[model samples]
Structures are given as C-alpha cells and as structure tokens.
Target: MGLGACSTQGPFEEKDRGPDRPVDTSHVPDAVPRHEVRTAAGNKNPYTVLGQTYHLMDDETGYREQGIASWYGKKFHGRRTSNGEVYDMYAMTAAHKTLPIPSYVRVTNLDNRRQVVVRVNDRGPFHGGRIIDLSYAAAQRLGFANHGTARVEVEIIVPGDQPPAPLRAEEASDAVAIPSGEQTYLQVGAFSTLGAAEQQRERVSGMVGYPVVIHSPEELPELHRVRIGPLTNTTEVAEVREQLRRNAIEQTHIVKE
Candidate 1:
C-alpha cells in the first residue's frame, strides 16, 4: 500500500475556511441518527498516518470521550472521504480515528454547552492529539468555528435515539420577534469633524453600493458617526463587513435601530 501522509487530509488542511460571509446555516439541521451497515471502505484496522498506526474500533458500544475538536471547511470540501463518500463541510459530519465508520455521535461543546449530532463518515484529525474533527457547519453550530478549537464531549449516539435538544436550561429563548421597522447598519467609522467623516464617507461609498451616512448625536455634537446602512439583514452586513475588511477596514460594528 502506497499510503502517504494522512490519506484523505494534508498537513495544511487546517487552513480551510468557509465563505466570506458564511451562509445562514441556522436553518441547516443536524444529522439525524440512523442505523448504517459497517463497511470495509474506511474501517481498515491498524491504519498508518504519518508513521503512527491507529486501529479502528470494533464497535462503538458505550463510547464516550472528551478532547479538543477542530473543524475543516473549503480545503476538503467535495473531496472523497475515508469511507469513499464525498466530504461536505456544510453537512453535519465528523472524522474520528477510532470510531467505527458511519457511526453517529452527539458532540457537545464544553465551552458553550452547545450540542449537535453528527455522522462519523471519515477518519482523521491526525494532528495535535485532537480527539475528533468536525465539519465547518458542526463547528459553527457548536459556536467554535472561528476560535479554531474547542473542548468537547463526544458520545456515540445509538440509532433511533432521539437526539437531545441543544438548548440549555438557563439560556434565554430567542423567540422574540424583531420589532417592525427595525433596521440594521454597519458603523464603519467615527470622527471628530464633519470634513473627516465626509472624506471617509466618500472612501467607503466607493467601496460598495450601500447607502453611506453621517450623523452627529445631539449629546455628542463633536462626534461624527460614519456608517453604512439600514442594510437588510446580518448576511448583507456580513458581506459589507467582509468587503471593508479586505480593504484594511477592521473597525466595524453592527448598528440596529
């Protein structure tokens, strides 16, 4: 066997990232647990990765562990996984070295206590003693995609077992509807003078088609606020923010009023 370093993933795969303004994945549900036949495709035992041999688990009965979790995105998206299935970074899936291929596990982010069920269809996370590797969407839902790594609890989920609702008892419900006429804005810059604000306005105006405005608060007459807004939603704000970020404009905050 001419197996090179880490068959499906390369050393630099951690550099993977999602879209500039990540798509709204809140609507994307977690992988529903289901029974699957164990196949020999990715279950070859005693596999070697970078000279270290790892054996696959014969079964996942009562398997549970805690360790660091990282996510993979565009770098491995659309690629063939260890089990001969296509890797989708947006899907609820994960890779584990020892777990049986096609197993289901409920991963709870220890940092945020956010939990999500994912299908383990691949093998890896061969670097950094990480116990598991999650897809980008799974990491996003766990609230640690940006931080790069998070402490997590991974427990095998039996098929047909109702996946736990991810809500926390103390967590305030987000069912509150946005007040009608509420608008979102991006506050890009602020200055002490109108001239500076207008100059920055002209600069940011050419950056995008979004409306640019300058307002001076009555309480702080000396303060000139330069903002781009009443944008439709967070997605548009994210796009504008990314565009500004690319132009070396890192100082931006959302404004909802």
Candidate 2:
C-alpha cells in the first residue's frame, strides 16, 4: 500500500530520505503468475482500516480495475507486511485493499503503454482516489516513480484451478499432511542480495529457534530465499507460524518445494 499521508509528505516523513538511487534493472523481471494457495491470513471479509470498511472478494477471477496508482518506498522497506513477509520495495509486488493477499496481477501504465506483472502481497492505498499501490521498483519500471502517481490498469491473472479451501485456525492443529510429492515450506523472506538474505535468516532462526535454510535457486540466483522446514504436516506448520507471530514476524507464505 502507498504510505498514508495527510499532505504531499506522507507517513514516514522522517524516513523519506530523498530520491531513491537508480539501480540495475537488467535483472529485474516482471512478476510471473503461478498457481498458489490463497493464504488464510489477511483474507477476512469486511475488514476495516483507518475508519474505512473494505470487503475482500471471495474470488478474484477476471478482476480488473482502472484508476490512480501510487508507489511506496524507503520508509516501509524491510518492514513486516500484512501477510507474513518482509516488504521489499525493489521487488515487483503491490498492495491492494481487497484482492487475495498472495495473488498476481498485471499492472499497466496507460499513458506510456508500459506494462508489468506484480504480485499482490499486502493491502492498502487508503488515500482518496487510488486503486492500487505499486512497489517503488515497479513504479520505476512503469516510468512513474518520479511522478508519484499514474493512470493504470490492474487485472488479476487467475491460475488454472481455484485455490484450495481456506484453512481454519483450529483445523491447523490436526490437519493432515500433504502428499510427499507436494511438500511445502514456509517462506519467510526473499532478498536480491545473499548477505541481506542471510541476515534475515539468522534473525528469524534466532527468534523462532528453527533451522532456517537459505535457498538460492540455480535459475534465479539473484533471489536468495529464507525458508523454514519442508514441514510435512500442517500441525507443525501452524506451530512454527505461531512462533513467528509471537516474535512479530508477519510476512510468510506456504510454498511448494
């Protein structure tokens, strides 16, 4: 979500440290749509924020909207997101008021015809007249980061089948194990730099006392992922997640390994 602000200077006024330095966009790819489960967290219907009520859609198939889009940066970087993951302004991700927390969407800057696919992972842009919030890097790629806001089209990219039924908190304790072929892990954080990823891994491991592994895929070597367990059963998954919550870690995802 874009930072909430009463005036041109938004929230995190103290942390707004000038313009962001230019970075290498050579390896910055657009978000790719893939089949993923809609996380149980952040999907509550009729949720309220800042005295405003917003209802989440039961399903986002074919969802599309056009309006003002804004980008957020520095102040919120590295902060825990609405979903249980750290916010990375450089990543091709976005925040919407109601879309499923872990869904993918294609965002297009109407004026320039520049389009980018972004993962929707957080909620916001509560400011008046804004439809969605793009990451700083996403806005840069769209050619509007310096302008603050732009006219854009946001469309959901639905995966083949509908996501699995949302799991309940109580059911997590006794939930059956997923098939061995579909082993899952809780992805806590991802970073473009291995040093940053390792730091997060150490922090999370110390907090949850779990053996966190840093996985850098051969194909996406730039992305260093910090994950915990090939957790076989949902019960163990729930327990570890709870520990993370207690330690104030909110951004997380159940990813198939």
Candidate 3:
C-alpha cells in the first residue's frame, strides 16, 4: 500500500491520491481472520522491485514487528494487485514485502492505539522506513488516513488458533470465546494518551463494576490499555460479559495473561 504507486510486482506504478469525492470509510468492518490457502500469485520467494530483491515468507507464523506504515488510495483503485485481486482502496486490505500472500495481520497504530485487521493481498512498500502498505480504508480505521503515515505494530494473526467467539460479531476479530484453565481480562479498549485511556476507564468502570485498570506494557509503553477483571474461571468471564452486554458494550477483547 505505498501511497499512489511506488512499486508493485506487476501492473502500473504511479502517483496516488484519495478519490475526488471520497467515500467515508470510518465504519468499515475489519477483514475477518480466516485460514486462507496461500497461493503462488504473489508469494515469490525472490522478487525484484525498484532494484531491490525481497523474499516472501512461506507463511506469517510468529511474524511481528513495529515500524512506519504508509497507505495506498484512489490512484491504484480497481487495478490488479500483486496477488491478482483488484485493489480496492476502501477495502480492509494491505500490501506487505515478505509476509505470505493473503495473511491476516493486526496493525495497531502506535500513535493513537487504534487497530485494524487487514488482509495482506499484495506486495510492496518499496519505500524506506515503511514496513507495511495499508489500504485507504484500513488507514482510516487505524486513525491515520489523514496523516499519510503512522508508526505501527504489525502482528500476524492465526485464525485457527483463536477461540471461537459466541458473544461477538462473527465479522469482528475483537472478542474471543471463553477459555479454560487460564486467567484472562476483558479489554474494552486501548489508547495512546493517558487522558484518553482514563476517560475510557471511567466509563467502563461504571458499566461493568469490575476492577478496571490501565496498563502500559513495557514493550509498548505508549499504549494505554483499559482492561477489566482477571477472571479466573469461565463462569466469572461469562458473568462479566453478560454485564457488558447489558451495558451495550460489544467490542470487548480477551486478553489472556
């Protein structure tokens, strides 16, 4: 998702921009994480782009990194991506240099703590310092479309490993199913600034009556996470989740510690 068009394994490369009358993608649903069979269309082990050679990973297992992210927009809209899928700037898709084609990645904007799961269907971002290229809609959901670029953490998501969610929307990767023999928390949200996290903390505390707290992990000190409960059992987790549902909170995520 290099802006406009910096590099591609195939097709035209040109300058990019938003649509003349851009459609609002603020509420675009995330691409659901699924077990997609990798294809050879864009997963070339050794590929050359802009005089540099890159090797695509056989799979995205255990892939995680933090770096700058750019985006692509209207300029390449409707054009075929490196993987043969038509580029839709408004879709929850992305381009990556090495990740396997069709890998689902969770990208968290380090500046605002906004996150989105994007399907990697193309190759690119030949630019320096950028780790991933996101679709316009993906960038918008991550709260960085207007800024053009953002520092972000990209983590590979294994769909088959995630517990099935009975309380959350089927299309959302936010919440997960109950677990056994493990401690967990309900993460209502995350923010970059302390003020924002505190505001959410106040609201969530009043809603669930659980021990709501904000934690900034050492690995990502800038992240202010708003979590509720260290529910020891599935019964407690279900009780808290029922209360959350009563409070109309549906975007809850499971944080297994």
Best TM-score among the predictions, by candidate number? 3
- lDDT of candidate 2 at residue 189, scale 0 to 100: 74
Residue 209 of candidate 1: its Cα lDDT? 75
In order, candidate lDDTs are 0.74, 0.74, 0.75
Q: Name the regions of candidate 2 deviating beyond 4 angstroms.
A: 1-20, 161-193, 196-257
Q: Which residue pairs clash within candidate 3?
A: 4-16
Task: Let me know the TM-score candidate 2 reaches against the reference structure.
Answer: 0.60
Q: Between candidates 1 and 3, which one is better according to TM-score?
A: 3
- Candidate 1 lDDT, 128-201, residue by residue in tens: 66888898778889998777788999999887566544533212343333346997677876554578789999
lDDT of 3 by residue, 166-226 (tens): 6444223434544576667887765546787799899888877579999777665545778
TM-score of 1: 0.59
Q: List the residue pairs that clash in candidate 2.
A: 84-250, 84-251, 84-252, 85-251, 85-252
Candidate 2 C-alpha lDDT tens digits along 1-257: 32232233332232442134455332456765666677766576787777778888887786999999987777677776677677777788988888988888889899999998889888777767888878877888899877788999998987545354365553455777778788677888767678888899888888765578998877666568789988877787888878986875645777785
Compared with the true structure, the alpha-carbon lDDT of candidate 2 equals 0.74
At residue 57, candidate 3 shows an lDDT of: 73
Clashing pairs in 1: none
